[model samples]
Target: MENQRGKGLSFARRIYRPRIIGLGIGAISVFATLYPLDLPNWTWALLVFNGLVWPHLAYQLSTRSAFPYQAERRNLLYDSLMGGFWTATMQFNPLPAVTILSMMAMNNVAAGGLRLFIRGSLSQFAGVLLSWALFGASFNTQITALQIYACLPMLTLYPLAVGIVCYRLAIKLSEHKRALSALSRTDSLTGLLNHGSWKDLLHIKFHKCQQRQMEASIALIDIDHFKAINDTYGHIIGDTVLRHLSSELRRNLRHDDLAGRYGGDEFCVILPRMSQSQALDVMERLRQIFSQYRHPQVPELKVSLSIGLAAFSPDFQDPSSWLNAADKALYLAKNGGRNQTANNAGKSHFEQTQMA
Candidate 1:
């Protein structure tokens, strides 16, 4: 029911403003033709009611309907009916009749595309037949100067209103598309890039370093004893610890650094334009920062990180090979001790900076 109302409001807003503008202009267009014929008093009153009051009444009817979009669509068909009636009553005067029918068609198309256009056209035909039966059918091709002036507002202003509405809707759709793209690439738990997005970035970074002959490093990080933490304090507390590590990474890492949740209890990072030594320093800082975090929910609890560092190399065949090096280094860190940073290159001793 709420959803229906939301749709109704959206339909109402789209139709209301334009109807007000179009009908106000339409009134002028129709009156110019009718005035010369010296329409009967009741006929004149009906024309004024339709031109001035019907727009507002139609808006109210559609908005209050259970299905607003469908209601607005019906209103558009009625507009076509009224347009045909006016055209026939004016004896098919070329300028005013054309303006009325064309504007009605435009409204129907805007509301429901080609299907509505056909349906509304049929409704207009029915209205023309009814008017012919009641008031006699005729044609007046001549359009006076006053009628032409009245037609100008409908021709120019209504199209502008339609264009403005369409432009604003396009902008809103573009923004929604961008937001959905970001959400797809991001992890809901840690607010970091998800596994697939991270891997794609790694592939891009790998080729970049190869072409530019520039230095960069990759690190794979694990939360030491993560399963044990979950066992001791439940998965909720374990999640808190993971979030803490992610927050620390955001605070310590450079703006250009890319970090992502690789999988359960593990994260990956790419440090661009940085050597092995700089990478190790950054990882070491991250490990220390994570170890110092004491959860407010469990004040006695502590967490630590085990990190592996690997530099981009000409010898590596692909991004997977570089990732393998970091994984191997991470294995060494866990084996050497639960909480330490390890570098896979050359004879660099495993940094045994463990925290209790």
Candidate 2:
């Protein structure tokens, strides 16, 4: 209910300025038609109120209502009714009447689509009938030059106001779309790329490396004894440990490098334009920094990483082959000792670097 009310308030605000512009301009068109007829004092007063006061009144009514959206819709119907009443008061002067009615129809359709258009048209018809009963039915189809000039502002300015509102709405929607797309591509826990997005980026990186013969490397990292940590402490502490490693990776890696959470306690990184030795140094520093971190909540907790490094080689067939080479190096790092970095370089034998 709160969300609905918020949306309703927003809807009312969006309509407020356009309503003011349309009605202020519309009054001129109606006045040109009614001037020759010499309507009563009360009718002139009503016209003044409608032209100058009603827009603000409608905004206040909708904004303060419990159901603001519904209130705004009611206000739109009132506008349609007033438009019909004015058209009849002019005895259906062709140019001014058609301009007023057409603009009201445009507003109804824009505000609430076909459903509101239908309802507003019915309200307008009722107003026409009320005017006929009070003033007697009469028709004056002639349109003077003065009436045409008066209608001009309503025709031009009202649509311009509506267009500006629509343009702003489109821009906001586009920004929201971009934000949602970013959220979908990101991991909730670590703020890194999720598994699928990371893999997609890896494929692009692999192709770039293969085509240009560029020196780049990939790393697969595991939180050492993560399951044991979770078992001893809790999943919460384990999550903290994972987030710590991700923070360390973000801080240590270059801006161009890509890191992603590769499911569970494992993470993957892409080091573009870097040799195997450079990649190893970067990963080793990250491992050392992370190993020394002490969780404030669990002061007894200590963490370490086992990382695997693989440089892009021409002998690799696909992105999967490159990934598998890194996986093999990770395995060697894990088997040799838990806290170290190892390089496979598309070879059977691994070159392992154990952290002291």
With a 3 Å backbone cut-off (N, CA, C), the pairs that clash in candidate 1 are none
* CA lDDT scores, all candidates in order: 0.87, 0.91
TM-score of each: 0.92, 0.93
Predicted candidate 2 versus true structure: per-residue lDDT over 1-356, tens digit per residue:
99999999989999999999999999999988899896689998999999999999999999999999999999999999999899898999999988999999998998999999999999999889888988988999788999999999999999999999889989999999999999999899999989999999999999999899999999999999999999999999888888888888899999999999999999999999999988888988898899899988888988888998999999999999999999998998889777888888532223432232
For residue 301, give model 2's deviation from the true position in Å: 0.8
Clashes of each: 0, 0
True lDDT of residue 170, candidate 2: 92
Report model 2's TM-score to 2 decimal places: 0.93
RMSD score of candidate 1 (Å): 2.8
